[model samples]
Target: MAAGIQQQNAAEDIVIAGAGLAGLAVALGLHRKGVRSVVLESSPERRTSGFAFFTWTNAFRALDALGVGDKMRGRHLQLQGLRVMASSTGEIAREMDLRVNGKLGPHEVRCVQRNVLLQALEEELPPGTVRYSSKIVSIDDQDGAKILHLADDSTLRAKVLIGCDGINSVVAKWLGLAKPSESGRTATRGYARYPEGHGFEPKILQFVGEGFRAGLVPWSDTDVYWFFTWSPAPSPDANGKEDRSAAAMNQFVLTKMRGAKVGPEVLEAVERSEMSDVLAAPLRFRSPLSLLFASISKGNVCVAGDALHPTTPDLAQGACTALEDGVVLARCLGAGAERGFGHEEGEDRPCLGDAIVGAGDGEERERVVAALRRYAGMRRWRSAQVIAASYAVGFVQESDHTVVSFVRDKLLSGVLAKTLLMMPDYDCGKL
Candidate 1:
């Protein structure tokens, strides 16, 4: 669509799959580095319909790293604190103050419409840099680079290919990474316009009950996005508590929020917004591996975003981490550095342009393997730690175990949350 955006030759600079936040972020990062890239999105165009999403200061830091922090801040309603409560009792279990961390710029967390974020990211890309409706059917590893075969029988080649495709990424397997694991539970996310007099404060409001937890986050002065995570219902009679069938989901929601603080207006808004389609599926994650792909780089080939690590939404860090990975991966390559394997800076280093340019079939495979191994070593543990924290969050917010739940919700709520909100201070940025 744009000059230098065509997929005709095998010598293009970089090709990124999936134009989600992760993909778009990577494209922007590459552009910042003066590297040209072409982003291929399976979605016909930017998805305008969806729920609201959360963005913590930690995520904001990542966004800042990519130079779009202020733009996002202008559009979102910065949350003052996180309110965790007992779902069944509606009793306040914990309250973590945003000011405690000092990480968030005046406010602690921000919620914005999912489509809004996507639109902001899309606007940053050079026009035509994104090719929608172009799904990647296959990825072939060449001697030094990777070739992407599209669904329409077209092909594109680049010095590097990143599979920013989501949890059900086809590129990971195509590139020989491990398959996704069967996550234990499912999540249903939706968005609705915040009606007048909803009575809910503009904060991250969570309700944890006997067997389920629902979160309500305000994305703007007039709208909020909420989600209900629960175990599948025991019976088929759709009353809305657990199953994802349209009727069942609707029924489940109706029953749960029937008398809760969600209010009649909010319920009416949710019903009026959209109900035929919802993002409902069992959560999944990659096995705790040293790395996602066999190697981070196969000669000039590499993977990024969920294509590398598909985490649960319990942490709300999936999109954040993907954006972080996209930025960091590009930095490592741009700086001509590779971690692990005692890779040192040398005059004629393999990580530099030499290996990329002279790589033959055999040498290319070996180089790619080495890069993948190195990439795994650099990122696996950190990703696992985040995943574990997210699982712990799920437990603290909705554990069935009585004693454990009490301790998690009561004893650990305030102090622990304060500590975590400051975790963005860690040096996860840069190579």
Candidate 2:
């Protein structure tokens, strides 16, 4: 509620909250379009917590548009397909081939460490683009600009505000968006490192157990990433507590995998993983109906990433869709600039300020809002499909009912390849 102050000073053209993958990608994409932005992160330094995750072809295409595709491909491990197996019998259930066929040639999926991707994006930006430890306290829209109140009592004003913060985004709340709901499942993940080498194939191996799921992917010759997910018993404390010691966490994971039909190599990899590398959290997602009906933008203020549509990990599309959001947003804003949204004719613009003034007239504000609306329209339907699919997959995979499990194990497995093939392919057109 920090309002009622109008200072006679120029403000940034764009202010993006949160320095996660989505935020950084937006900044990088904007830079590619001759725009500049300041990123605000609450953390004191770089975040180095999360493990590795899969990046599908659509994600690679987005990265390519951002001008980092080759760099990312060179630094990660590529795989051909995903192999699903039965945890009870260790028998193959389904195989999802991700390789591009015919004229497309070779399109490979890769798994890259979260920290590595973050570092890659941060390095691409100009120095001082991101301000660390600058948490947002509140936001106010006044006179065609967004005024952000920082935790340190300082303030920033921008012609446009983008919320790339994650699921627990403060920006989303200010925009009146609903909070994400828990998916009733918990997941634990970590990277296992072997000093020698792990002779595993370059395919993602998954095992579906009774009301539980496990997967492992070789990240490199000496490191492997693995995950285990399950639904805890319904109770007041079903979400579990945090602050557990590393030893306790490792023990818990070992206990969960006991008697499973997972191969010895996978078991050895888990045993070799350092206790500190393991992380556990409850899975959460936003329903497709809510996302499809929600207002993603108000005036020139909008959100991206999990802030807009947070889906479950069933399809591994959360980060991919977030990356797509960044590129699409940048394209829309860049097109608006070409149409003279903020700049005067024949102006030699050097930064975002030259393209859009913070305190513009009604005409300029309307143009900016129109551009944001275009971005929302382009993303809403596609994101809704991903959210719905992810939710359905999670429901089927984590169901405790015998009929649901039987259908999933018998009928669904046969159609997974077809379903995966039907997913839309994205290409963020020229910047």
lDDT of 1 by residue, 1-431 (tens): 32222346445556778888778887776666555567888777786654566676666766777778788889877777777777555678777666453643443468766677777777877778888888878777665566777777777765666778876777767667677776666677666664663455667777764556677777777666777776543354456454566656766676767755444544664575467645566677776544533554445455667777776667677776776776766555444333211122232334323345443334443444455455556666666666666665665565657886677666877654654564444344742
Give me the runs in candidate 2 sitting further than 4 Å from their true place.
1-10, 100-106, 233-245, 341-347, 350-360
- Top candidate (TM-score): 2
**Candidate 1 TM-score, true structure as reference:** 0.82
lDDT, candidate 2, at 5? 20
* Candidate 1 lDDT score at position 307: 78
- The local distance difference test score of model 2 is 0.77
